[model samples]
Target: MSGVQTPSIDFDAFIFDLDGTLLDTADDLGGALNRVLADANVAPVAEHIYRPAASNGANALLEAGFGDKWPELEQLALRQQLLDYYAEDIAVHSKCFTGIEQLLIALEQNNIKWGIMTNKPGFLTEPLVQAIPSLSNAQAVVSGDTLSVAKPSPDPLLHTAEILEVDPSRCLYIGDAERDIQAAKAANMYSATALWGYIPSVDAALGWQADFNWHSPIDGFNHI
Candidate 1:
């Protein structure tokens, strides 16, 4: 007699990191950073220098670019300038990664609810999500400033799941950074490492220990 094969489990919900995972906003962010630096009479940092740290938020960019000489007040002012510039040009060089649109469409068609859990500030995060035609209907959105604590703390991820009315265990979180994995694990959710997103000089395997790793958005559909 032949035995029957088991069917793979399908996730009920999906959660994503915004900056590096879903959208490639580094170019737009870098442009804003350069503008801020120039307006402050400081030399601009190279694109590569700012790309890897883009997910860390505007403060990290300001610190990395002007920490040595600028006083706290000046740094805050510059950060505001960068934020203003980014809001107007959020989509200038920013776009969804290749195959991501298809993956998202597939998920929606399969009845898999998805939302965003990003450390990006709400002001920018909300507008960017609204601007993206594909992401306009996300189930929920949790921004860094949405709560007292952000990613790597599990607060944002947990909060997202709560709002989506899904259990953390039923959600599959995808991200490109170690902090994203840390947040997912802390929330007791399944996590996938996005190999196509920015990894800088760090190895995702060693740093994140993600449940699964994929080279592209289409590759992720297989794991899901």
Candidate 2:
């Protein structure tokens, strides 16, 4: 057989998913929810109770934590409470995952443009990213509210690439959810699954078809 050769593609930029990809934000989010529950005179929800559903946003947390007792009339109230609580305690226990700092510094040192593309709503997404010293200088950050469509639709990823002045195909997108892979695929970008992030048991790789999979942020450094 003839010797095989692999095609080499140079990546020019990177797009990251906010919650699970870069930050270990579950603790902050859970604390916010528990605060809201306590203020409502409800029993505090276990911090780990919301881990699986954290990436789904406030509604999921409320539903999972309170179920039918989450009164619609208090929806806005509870949401506001959670937001306020989270904002003040945003980075208290939240921190970059192991090797994330080094990876970010490496990307910067290499002069590679990197940004965030997240399904997180602007209210939480913007503040959380801004608070992270490492991501303070990000090239771009596209949130769920930044576009009419979110992940699983190519709009956000495409928008992020455009804002970063990078070609979509030359950008690498890393995320822990199927929607993240779907968005990257739709944008014609290279996609990788972040195995360290918050993927639920029901989430399967068959739907995502990521271009690659890395167990941690450092593992992605070489590929990027």
Candidate 3:
């Protein structure tokens, strides 16, 4: 049944995108965005509507709240307000996705190193990761602030592979965004798209061009 001894890859390391890929963090992010909208006396966005935008970061989330008003509104000020509010309640409703704990355990049992690589600033990413036991002890963490250039540049992913002491070719990277796929390809790493991550309802995962696509943590983890 093992048939032709299927070509297999022993991924030495796994790197993940923080927000939508690893954690269900929409609540805190959406919550903060709504607060900022309220301060502007605008109607708050429904949580379900903002969930997808949350994964894209503060700028996108803020734009969702601002809507047409975004053009005339000052993005920087609103983004700061959103960030400030988010900092106040970082991990309130955040938690690992279902099966992630099992995946992490499996990785550990197999002696595969796992880490985080996200565009979120280190200041915010560090505390958030620390608050979650499973996330805090990653083998390496390459945050947006860790380097001047961010993802889609491949620098962060390459940096992470170096820090983990694994060849880029031996690492598997999972993320929810298209940039994640681009970075992985550029770094010559395997790319797996986390289909369950917070992709906007208007977007399609087909365009990401990842090596493989997994709809849930179990599916993705098992694929590796």
Clashes of each: 0, 0, 0
- TM-score of each candidate? 0.89, 0.87, 0.94
Best by lDDT, which number?
A: 3
Q: Give the total clashing residue pairs for model 2.
A: 0
* Candidate number that wins on TM-score, 1 or 3: 3
* Candidate order, TM-score descending: 3, 1, 2
Candidate 3 Cα misplacement greater than 4 A, ranges: 1-8, 201-203
**Alpha-carbon deviation at 76 in model 3, angstroms:** 1.1
TM-score of 2: 0.87
Clashing pairs in 2: none
Instruction: Assess the local accuracy of residue 192 in candidate 2 as a C-alpha lDDT between 0 and 100.
Output: 80
Better of 2 and 3 by TM-score: 3
Clashing pairs in 1: none
